[model samples]
Target: MTTDTIITARGLTKTFTVRKAVVEAVTDLDLDVQRGELVAFLGPNGAGKSTSLRMLTTLLPPTSGTATVVGHDIARDPAGVRRRIGYIGQGTSAGHNQRVRDELLSQGAFYGMGRRAAATRADELLESLDLAPLATRKVLGLSGGQKRRLDIALGLIHSPELLFLDEPSTGLDPQSRANLWQHILDLRREHGTTIFVTTHFLEEADLFAERVLVMDHGRMIADDTAGNLKTTLAGDVITLGFASEADARAAAARAGGTAAGSSLSLTVDHGELVLPRLLRELDSVTSATLRQPTLDDVFLALTGRSLREDAATSKEEINA
Candidate 1:
């Protein structure tokens, strides 16, 4: 492991027995997450994401190998790991009968905080999470957005060193989801708590993570900044269309130096990645379109399939 790594797994393996057959969920996997980094753990459903998280958080034991969370061995120091990490599963936090504020305060007090300190911290977090107006409301009466926010406040009440969020904003409305994302940014900026989260939203993974790790079949396939992933994916394509077939053909030939696609009524002759002097050729052309490279392109290039497809296939394998 590197000097700054806070989460380390070496030769990690996990297996489960179902019926009369043994299945391997994770095999000889090595993972390292740096301190103070918000790492996104993503994959198709049943890609051992929840299982891996459970092992790290001490909810389940690994079949073999070692993992250390926050510098504490998961096997030897389960309590230490628990004390250092706050986990929010893919579920709601509120009890139907409890008040939001009361729930938060109780969470704080459970961690040995005094009543006064717990109450103060709870109120502060309630306001910070935009739950102040709903602080006194019954959990059952709160909106989905409000309840999720309260769940976050509860997760943070103890000032944990790390937070594990599994699809924290899965069912939130767009506005609520945006609010939650901003809050996550603020949490990292203000408290420096290292976070590990999982999500199916590719856009979220693209935008939020400083560095993202993509996984398939419980194995990591790629890890890098989103831009870098896109830049080296494929060759560029330029298309030119015109009003009339002849105009289209002329424009296409002028830009592409050949014919264009069938849908392209105009007549670009050839469609190769590298055409002759593109600028010089297109300088005289007026009607044309260019497809800039993007992360999706990179994802497809790297995975040999679309991200959505990879996710679905992974889900099937996991289920099988």
Candidate 2:
């Protein structure tokens, strides 16, 4: 592993035997995560996102391949890797009957912190995550958002250099999601913590992360910035409406676009530049509109499916 790389994995693979059938959870994966980078890992259900995170966090060993996290080999030195990383899974970590402050303090103590130091760190985290007012409240009495906040506090009690968050904002309301994101950003800004997160929320990944890693069917499909993926994979969609169907067909023929009834649609890399040139050439254009490609568009272009739909379907299957 390089000095700046906090995580390095090569040829990683994991498989499970389920009811006499084999399931490949991750396959021949290679990855590197640099220090202080806030990266989002995105995929559908059973797409290896969580599997990869578990391998990297030393929670689950890969069946084959090698990985080094925080300068320690994942298989050979899991304790070393664990000491330098904090993992907050999908569910809350605090005990239901414990006070929020006491839970945090207990976490610090588990890391071998002195009573005074644990109390100090507990108070600091409560204030930072906006859980100070509810510090004395029992964990079971707290709302969903508050419980998640306490989970984060529990993960950070030891101030690990790297943090792994699995569906951190999965069940939060929009307002609570906003608040959680703010606190997460604040943690990165103040502590330079390397954050590796898995989320189903497309907009959250698009707006918050510096880089995105997309996976499908146990394999990594794409790795790049959200803007780059949208620009390169699924360019801007340009739609032009004409007064007559014949005019739309003519415009489509001239612009190499697809025509449907009275509208011509074409995708171009730079809509701003293409729109002006197109309008000048096509005199019969009655209306023109440009729609910028989003991260979902990139996914659709790559896999012929939508991540949003996958998430909804996954939820439905779980309920069923």
Candidate 3:
């Protein structure tokens, strides 16, 4: 492994049996994550985002394949991997009965810190995550967002080099979610922490992560910078409105575009390069517009389904 590589996996696979039916949660996943990089893993439910994370964090052993996390083999040295990484799962990991500061100190103790060192670390995390005021409050008395912050502080007590966050903002209100993101970004900037996060919020992933990985049906479908994926896979959509339906059809045929009513639409790799030529070639063109693609459009183009819709439907199916 390279010195800069924080995570390396080869053909990582996991399977489960539910009601005598075989289910492949993750299949043949190969991944590499470098130091100090923030990456987002995005997919609908049952897309293996959590399964893959569990394997890398050593919470769930992979059925096949192998991986090394933070320079330690996941199978052979789970303790070493655990020591070097912090994991905040979907549910809050803080103890309900303990005081916020006590819980943080306990986490530090688990990592084998001296009492004074643990207390110092706990105070630092409490201040950093905006939990200093609530340090003396019982964990059970805190609000949802406060509890979530405590969970993050617990994870960071050891100051691991890498942090794995599984849906950290899932249950937060809009303002709280925004606050959490700011803290996460600040952690990366100040501590040079490598963040590997999985979130259902497409917009957050698009806006925050340096790189995005899209998984579907237990397989990784796309991996690239969000801007590159949108531009390369989905492209820019150019629409031209003609004077009449017949004119639109004629112009579409000449331009090799799709015709609808009085409009002709074509997706081009570079809309600016093609727009002027299209205007000159199509005499009946009245109005022309070019639209940039979003990460949602990229997902739709790759999987033939909207990720937002898939996520909602999957949730409903599970509840039913």
Count of clashes, each model:
12, 0, 0
Ranking by TM-score: 2, 3, 1
TM-score between model 1 and native: 0.82
Against the true structure, candidate 3 has what lDDT?
Answer: 0.91
CA lDDT scores, all candidates in order: 0.74, 0.90, 0.91
lDDT of 3 by residue, 259-301 (tens): 9999989998878889999988787889999998888898999
Cα lDDT tens digits, model 2, 50-126, are: 88888998888899999999899999999898888999988889999999998988888888889999999999999
Model 3 spans > 4 angstroms off: 1-3, 253-255, 272-288, 316-320
What TM-score number comes out for model 3?
A: 0.92
How well does each candidate superpose onto the true structure, as a TM-score?
A: 0.82, 0.95, 0.92
- Candidate 1: where are CA atoms >4 Å away? 1-3, 234-277, 283-286, 292-295, 309-320
Model 2 deviation from the true structure expressed as Cα RMSD, one decimal place: 2.4
Better of 1 and 3 by TM-score: 3
Task: Please list the residue runs of candidate 2 whose C-alpha ends up more than 4 Å from where it truly belongs after superposition.
Answer: 1-3, 315-320
